[model samples]
Target: MSGQPNRKFDLALTGRRGGNVWTIDGEPYPDANPLSVQPGDHVRVHMVNHSPVVHPMHLHGHFFQVGDAVQDTVLVPQHMGEVTFDFIADNPGDWLFHCHNLYHLDAGMARVITYVQ
Candidate 1:
């Protein structure tokens, strides 16, 4: 990660919606599982959108590198479009990762990023 040797991880996720219920990897809201990593570890998440609506993916509390830009949010086009972002877990805490669309978030497309010691 940027030539700094520490720790790293990779994750894959999928976005889907059904009957007003939006989900990440088939689980909705608080029910969706967290991706566990430690402080200072580099984490990469690749998201695939299978839903009909576009998802502006967001990560709380930390900025991530997506393509050539560093951003807190990235847009994943619908219908199999995919996006990959990487970040160093400098802020150690539980955080939310989800779609930024109000309706989509309210409909339950969210997951937690749990930082473990």
Candidate 2:
């Protein structure tokens, strides 16, 4: 879309009894999917909920606009809600992105997106 490369990616958040688990690129995240990016690249995160409960996604250090929230947290309803977020990989470093629920993070529903040199 913009000057940066427009890449489409989908992440799934599955709800469990107490928390949720996340998957990226068809693999279990954190231990499996390590986000890789380059400077100027535009990434579109299409977060889909596969579980029966709602999940609020959050990204640290970067402010994203999904609807109107200036902060990072966004509410995604169960099994049907999907949030589309775009960001320019200008900051070259590793940034954490995941569900806002602390229990979800403990349940492996978190990941780090890295912008390379």
Candidate 3:
């Protein structure tokens, strides 16, 4: 396990059928509030999938520890299933977090993790 997460966020992964729009925490991509942290902070994200399809959640610029392994992405299954992972925010910048599915990414299943100054 990496550094223990001091900051935590719970996100709800959702989607709209008719329009094929994807969302995180009820907000779509650009509209979703960025997860903010400071350098050296350990962060954990609890992701809950509410949609009917699977979403491979990817994080840029950081690899997170889930259980015994470290990875940059993890698959989140449908039907309200959840996954939790933690990462150290040692990099200072705006990093993207999104669904690996190209269609879902295009549909707005994304947000940013920002390192505060």
Candidate 4:
């Protein structure tokens, strides 16, 4: 086993009418909960739309790549597709991840990701 640890974390978010209910390891993170991350880690966000409609996802501060070095404001089509994106946790800060729907944000469909020092 390598002394240096390579960690992979999966974040699952559900898209609904109001907002997203996020679960990390099957537990809900309360509103305004501090999102802590570490450097040299890989993050995989598996966004699933449980709603009858579609939602577009965005990750702020960190421009991510999906299969290639392309900027994506991806729309998760209803009941069909799941958009997956990965990023290297290089920058450290409180970053926002949420749906691009204005009303959805108004409805509280947002969360913060914080990289610890």
Best by TM-score: 3
Candidate 2: tens digits of C-alpha lDDT, residues 1-117: 334336556887775564345543335556866677887777778887877777788887677655444557888788667888777667778888877777766667777888766
List clashing residue pairs in candidate 3. none
Which regions in candidate 3 have their CA more than 4 angstroms from the true location? 2-4
lDDT of 1 by residue, 8-117 (tens): 33333344455578888777887777878888787878787877778888999999997789999999888778887788989988999888987788887888899898
The all-Cα superposition gives candidate 3 an RMSD in Å to the true structure of 1.4
Alpha-carbon shift of residue 90 in model 3 (angstroms): 0.9
Best by lDDT: 3
lDDT of 2 at 70: 52
Arranged by TM-score with the best first, the candidates are 3, 1, 2, 4
TM-score of each: 0.86, 0.80, 0.93, 0.71
Candidate 3: tens digits of C-alpha lDDT, residues 4-117: 678999999999555578999888888888999999888889999999888999999999998998899999989998999998888889999999998888989999999986
Candidates 1 and 2 compared by lDDT, better number: 1
Q: Where is model 1 poorest over a 10-residue stretch in terms of lDDT?
A: 4-13
What lDDT would each prediction earn against the true structure? 0.78, 0.70, 0.90, 0.61
lDDT of 2 at 90: 72
